[model samples]
Target: MKKAIGKAFLAITGWKGEGAPPEHGRYVLIAAPHTSNWDFPFTLAFAWAYGVEMRWMGKHTLFEGPKGWFFRAVGGVPVIRHERRSMVQQMVDLFTEHDRLALVVPAEGTRSLVPHWKSGFYHIARGANVPVVLGYLDYSRKTGGFGGLLEPTGDMRADMDRVRAFYADKVGKFPEKFGPIRLKEELEADEIAAAKLAS
Candidate 1:
């Protein structure tokens, strides 16, 4: 049902899916270069086309009433904005509880351009001892799908360097709206290192 729905949607929208299904049973899927509202549906459709079940965090309010069932069926996990548990921990817990799960995390955290990518996806994958899979949407070619899988090597800068390379050619719906593929954590580390060297 989902595969058919995804194929039909893509065919109607004229978007082509590139890349293959991930081989890992459990991993953190990084939804990157998110620059438009349409990314949500396209991302879901791309996942469905590949028969990948992706769970993502949605607003707690979005899960209210009858619409809640639909959202949940589509792998939307309601997250309370003020919850005490950090989202990373919440996601890690979910991973620990499930044997085979693909937690979809929009590392950009928003459609608008930001200074850096959020590091929660990296932290969650590390905490759960799972690999991080790069999921991309190249609007330039109207293509979307899995690009590659990367294990969190605990070396932030080196790991992110590899991530940077994978997305170097991927374009978003709004190219100007795509920010640098970097983590603030890494930037801070670089600052700290420079400070130490100057001293």
Candidate 2:
């Protein structure tokens, strides 16, 4: 029923998916160019269309209300973003516990522009000893699906370069809001320097 609903949603919206979802038992799925609210529903539809039951994290508060049960039923996990807990290790432990887990993370972290992407997804995949599947939603083409997988080599710069290349051609709903996909460390220094100069 979910699969059929996903297909119908895509068909009605005039959107098509390209590649198949990951066939592996465990991996980190990172979606890019998440610049609009529409990305969420489109992503859910794409996943269901491919018969992929993916787990995604939401703020802990989202899991506290009446609709919380519905969210959990759809694979939503509560995450305490402001806590000091080691999220990467927690995710790694989840991989260890589950024989098959495909965790979906939106690297951009927000719909508005940011200087760099959050590196939590990369760390989670690396710590869990799993591949990172590149998921994309290209609004220009009305297409969305997995692109491919990346095996982290502990080389942050090179690995992120490949990620940027993969998403280079993918267009988001708000193109101006999508910045280059770079590491947080790389951009933090620039942000700090800019702040210093402004003072």
- The numbered model that scores best in lDDT is 1
- Candidate no. 1 TM-score: 0.94
Q: Candidate 2, TM-score vs. the true structure?
A: 0.91
lDDT tens digits, residues 46-97, model 1?
A: 9888899889998899999989999999999887768898878888889889
lDDT minimum window of 10 residues, candidate 1: 16-25
Best by TM-score: 1
TM per prediction: 0.94, 0.91
| Clash pairs for candidate 2 | none
Runs in model 2 with CA error above 4 Å? 81-84, 188-199
lDDT of 2 by residue, 1-199 (tens): 8899899999999999998876798999998789999998999898888888889988889999799999998889888777677777778888899988889999999999988899999999989999999999999999999997899998887898899889999999999999878988767766898999999
Total colliding residue pairs, candidate 2: 0
lDDT of candidate 1 at residue 193, scale 0 to 100: 95
Q: lDDT per model, in order?
A: 0.91, 0.90
